[model samples]
Target: MLTIGEFAQLTHLSVRTLRRYHDAGLLEPARVDQASGYRYYSAEQIPAAQVIHRLRELDVPLPDVQRILQTPDPGTRAGLVADHLQRLEDQLERTRAAVTSLQRLLRPEPATLDVELRAVPATTVAAVEATVELDDVLAWYSGAMAELDALVGTPGPPGGLYDNELFTTGRGRVLVHRPVTAPPRTGRVHPVTLPAVELAVTTHVGDHDTIDVTYGELGSWVVEHTLAVAGPVRETYLVGPRDDPDPTAWRTEIGWPVFRLAPG
Candidate 1:
């Protein structure tokens, strides 16, 4: 038999932690002196103490550690630890994504863009229109684009119209259009005349994660040059996922419907 201090020395766990473990019924001593209230651990308990120490270092919850210790079956004990490890991995991924977003927000690179004001003539298009929640936009867009591609057969680079309410409210209307020589009238694909409008446009080169930064810069330019937004925002995919799998080579034109302010 080894004294509590000896067990602590062997396991490298502090005396205070061993005492707390005793109180928590995690690593009870092999024998306790009733008169002096002293705790003593046997050498056999050293392995269990070491396991507890490692689990705690990994940030495993106390309840989970207790479950692992109380479980007699080796497979059940391993499963408990594995489950917590998986949770830690998931949390690490989320932390990495958040850090990337924060870095983009705080250290923005200087933007050099050419903003143009042009009038787009009315045109007929084969389109898929629907109302979608912001959270579902990505999945919805993927399916919508697939359907449009199958129906239109690569008519032109695909584009989308996003209503202002989509940004203001949680859900709004979205229209995915493909420019075609002759608009088709098929299931969920119909001919629609897109109204003519003047736009303040800028190109977003790369992935959508940082596309908001480009939008902010373009919007600021519009206000500085005295332009008022007129209608839903338009996105023209000049070179996109359909053309290239590499996001670094993707090019999208973000067009905000705008009208010049009258001279005061």
Candidate 2:
């Protein structure tokens, strides 16, 4: 039997941690002296203590550590550890994505995008419109766009209109349209006339992950140029996944309906 100090040396765990583990029933000592209040551990307990130490270092919850130690089957033990490791990996990936997004936002170079004001004429289109939750937009758009593509058969580049409530309330109407030669009255695809509107437009080149930064820049420009937003936002997929698999090659135009203020 080894004293608590000796066991601490072997396991590289602090004496206080060993006592806490003992209190938590995670690593009980081999024996305790009732009269003097002394704890002693067997040499065999070293491996168990080390395993608990390693798992704790990985931020595994105390309850999980206890479960791992109590589990008799090796497969069950391994499965628990593997599940925690997979969660760690997922968190790391999310952290990396967040870091990359922050770097794009705080880069040394200023976001200098060319803004244009243009009047779009009224046009007829085959479109699919729905009121969807923000989280479901991507999957919903994919199916909707696929349906449109199959029905329209290589019409003009696809575009969408997003109501402001989508951002403000987390649920709103979205309309995806394609300029076909003529409207096809097929399932979920119908002809609609989009009215003319003036817009403040800017292009976002790359994936949608960083598209918010471009939107911020363009919105700021509109305010600085004394333009008031008038209607729903529009997005034109000039070169999207349908045109190119490479995200870097994708080019999307963001258009905000706006009316120019008269010069003071």
Candidate 3:
């Protein structure tokens, strides 16, 4: 058995830290002096102490650390660590995307976006739609798209209609559909004819992380060109994550229904 001081030296952990771990029920001493209330740890406990230290160094939650140590399976412990690391990686990617977008937005002289006006005729397609909360948009989109693919085989590029209230009121109907000559009549799939409309269109080239910047630019163009928004915004995915892993190659076309305002 090693005294608290000797164990701290062997494990490279402070005596106070070891005591705190004991109080938290994380690590316990092998023996204790009843008369003096002193703590002592055996050499066998050194590895366990080091494991706790490593997990804490990575900022793992105390409860999670305890769960990892209590479970005897090495694979289970590794899997937990992997999941936490993946969450950290995803947050880092969002931070990088935000930085990239802000830098472009803050530029003194931003480049002009090519905005076009066109008339789109009514068309029918295999579709899945729902009333979605703002926070649930991405998850709902994925589920709808996957179901569409399973049923329709993605005959052509897929598109979505986003209601304006979804942005303004935080909850509204959203429709996602694939272009099919004959729309399916199975499951959540149905034929929905898009109404004919005039649109001011622009293409965003990259991941959806910063797609809002493109939307802002398109809206600004409409206000400047004396056009009034008339209907739901449309998004056509020309090349997306499902089709290409390289973000640089992805293309999404955004269209806002519009009508020319009366000249003042």
Give the best candidate by lDDT.
3
- Please, what is the TM-score per model? 0.67, 0.68, 0.88
> lDDT rank, highest first?
3, 2, 1
The Cα error of candidate 1 at residue 130, in Å, is 0.9
lDDT of 3 at 210: 94
Which model, 1 or 3, shows the larger lDDT?
3
Q: Model 3 residue 7 lDDT?
A: 96
Report the lDDT tens digits of candidate 2 across residue range 1-264: 999999999899999999999999999999999998899999999889999999999999999999999999999999999999999998886677677679877889876789888899998999999999999999999999889989997768999999999998999999999998788998999998999999999999987877888898898899888899988999999998888999889999999999978888
Q: Write the per-residue lDDT of candidate 1 for residues 1-264, one digit (tens) a residue.
A: 778788888899988999999998999999999999889998889888889999999999888899998899999988889999999998886676567557766775654569999899998899999999998999999988888888888867889999988888979999999999888788888988899999999998876766777788788888889999888999999998778999789999999999988999
Give candidate 2's whole-model lDDT: 0.92
Given candidate 2, what's the lDDT at residue 171? 100
User: Which should have the higher lDDT, number 2 or number 3?
Assistant: 3
Preferred candidate (lDDT higher): 1 or 2 = 2
| Each prediction's whole-model lDDT (CA) | 0.88, 0.92, 0.93
lDDT of 1 at 53: 93
Model 3: residues with Cα > 4 Å off, grouped in runs? 1-20, 32-38
Candidate 3 lDDT over 97-123, as tens digits, reads 999899979999888999989899999
